[model samples]
Target: MSKPFSQACENNKQPILDKLLVHFRQASRVLEIGSGTGQHAVFFAKNLPHLQWHCSDMPANHAGINQWLADYPSANLHAPVPFTIGQDSWPLELVVDKVDAVFSANTTHIMQRSEVPIMFDLIQKNLPEGGIFCQYGPFNVNGDYTSDSNRDFNQYLISQGCGGLWDIADLQVLVSGLDLLHQYALPANNKLLIWQKC
Candidate 1:
């Protein structure tokens, strides 16, 4: 089987890593919720050797993720972890022993609106006090789109029957248990939001 690839992942990995380095500088372990293609796993683990990067997703993506992990072979990077979303028990399954941070990119807007709250709930339950959750994706503020591209993207997502451009404020309301730390605007009109378990 050939390695799966995502051009967007390739483009965003470095910038994401730069932000992660600052926020998770002291973190020893991070659980990446949707490790699509394992590109971020390889790149981040190579760059931030101090933290253990655990890559996980639904079983279907495991093969591709494992292929990348096998090729990279970082002692600190663990990939091919299988997980189910919105199961309530799902996050606990992935949590296993210890996790200092949780990261998921480009997942929230693709999931159903109902599932977004569930994901937040699970992250809240799994992360210890003060643990950070880094979520990167396009988001709205007060029901307003930040860019024309994001507006179009939201429409496209709606056409596909998926939730799109979740409101950053709405997310804060959903995960009220978590404190919003930082919100960084990225190159592609996307945003990286950091929230800490309070």
Candidate 2:
């Protein structure tokens, strides 16, 4: 592909940046997980001059991300680092420097349910106290889907090998070390959840 594209990323990048601009203003380094297509990394890095943006994904997605980076090369934007949550020393091996913020968009429900906590474990190990982690996706509240669309989406995804939508309550229990700081309701019934390491 000349340059991978994501309509979802195109639609939501600005809104995500609106929050991260203020939220991560002080953050010097940001590690983006599941950087599908590397679209968000390029957009965010270009807009947010203060942060050094690091894009990461599985080896399968490296070329797409690298293509994006090469096309819109930024001094603060780094290339992809092999990342598979739960693998031993994967983060340390790929990420050479310390990171204060972790960002991932629309990835939780697409990954295996059992893999979610492992992802959190890796973030917890790397993100220091007071570090921020922002996740953008559709999620549930009180064990209930927020809308019929989300319910149908969850069912459709579960029918495949992908995980279903997650609930805030369950996530709080799963990653108790991180304190819920703010929850922003985004368009299309999606959400942007910000957590700070405790």
Candidate 2's C-alpha runs over 4 A off are: 88-90, 93-96
Tens-digit lDDT string for candidate 1 (1-198): 888999998889989999999989978888988888898889989999999888888888999999998888999998656766775365454557688799999999888888888888887877889899999989998889999989999999999998877888888877867899899998798899999999
- For residue 102, what is the lDDT in candidate 2? 93
> Model 1 Cα displacement at 142 (Å)?
2.7
Relative to the true structure, candidate 2 reaches a TM of: 0.95
Q: How high is the CA lDDT of each candidate model?
A: 0.86, 0.89
What lDDT tens digits, residue by residue, belong to model 2 across residues 3-90?
Answer: 7789989999999999999889888999989999999999999999988999888888999999999889999999888887756454
Sequence-dependent TM-score of model 1: 0.94
lDDT of 1 at 165: 77
Clashes of 2: 0
Candidate that would win on lDDT: 2
- Local distance difference test, candidate 2: 0.89
Model 2, residue 127: displacement in angstroms?
1.0
